[model samples]
Target: MAATVEAVIAALRVTLEEAQKSREASWKVEAVNRWIGQLPGSWSGRWRRLVLKSDASGNARRDELVAHVRAVIAFLETNRQQIAQSRKWWPLRRRWPANSPIANAPVAAPASSSARPVNLLRVRKPMPGIH
Candidate 1:
């Protein structure tokens, strides 16, 4: 009976542990990124199979686009640490660079929150809109 009670207590304590909170935060960010990453794959598949025209009023389209841009900027700021700045968004466990000295060895967690996740996008015509 005592052993059982102790086991239950330990299980309950796991949620309150620092490691658990860190893992939860890390997982939340990773899961979100994984979902975002899937869009390109699915979009390309759909794009190849569909021939569709999109049209909308300048104001309506402008409003929608502006809203999306704001949301994206907020999300990026909030999740900057969780993102793999180099596009490496490796499973946080596999976040290390292969050529790095420690990369050959297994890393239990990331090096540091400040070290990763910078969202950079490039386009041939950039400056007018890069910001």
Candidate 2:
């Protein structure tokens, strides 16, 4: 039960971090607000009182702020992988690359430091003028 709880928390943290990065990188204010809006009141309230108050949107501290955010995201990702593996989620563990589809069984192991580039080319084109 503890493992499950931790896994759920890790998953949510990853989701929130990705949402935040998408918003910051793309100027998606509505998306950012929506992500916050979906959170439980207590979580957001606590974060606002703690991190947000300390993290005034001042340009002089921009680098420090961004670094802190990135650190949090890194921590989240690490724990998420740990919790998933502890639960024997093969798709998350025993895989050469973290995001690759799980093989039927462990075949060949790849170095953890090796980075694989993801190809994002999709087959279908968007309906005209959608973006």
Best by TM-score: 2
lDDT of 1 by residue, 1-131 (tens): 23332332343244224333342222222222222333223234421221111244212232333333344435434544544232322234655677888767765885567575655653354477667
Tens-place lDDT per residue, model 2, 1-131, is 33543544454465556554543432222322332333223144522321322323322233444454455445435655553444332234454666556644568886577676656785566788886
TM-score, one value per model? 0.24, 0.25
User: Per-model C-alpha lDDT, please?
Assistant: 0.36, 0.42
| Weakest lDDT window of 10 consecutive positions for candidate 1 | 46-55
Q: Which stretches of candidate 1 lie over 4 Å from their true place?
A: 1-60, 85-131
Candidate 1 similarity to native, TM-score:
0.24
For every model shown, the clashing-pair count is 3, 0
* Clash count (model 2, backbone only): 0
Give candidate 1's whole-model lDDT: 0.36
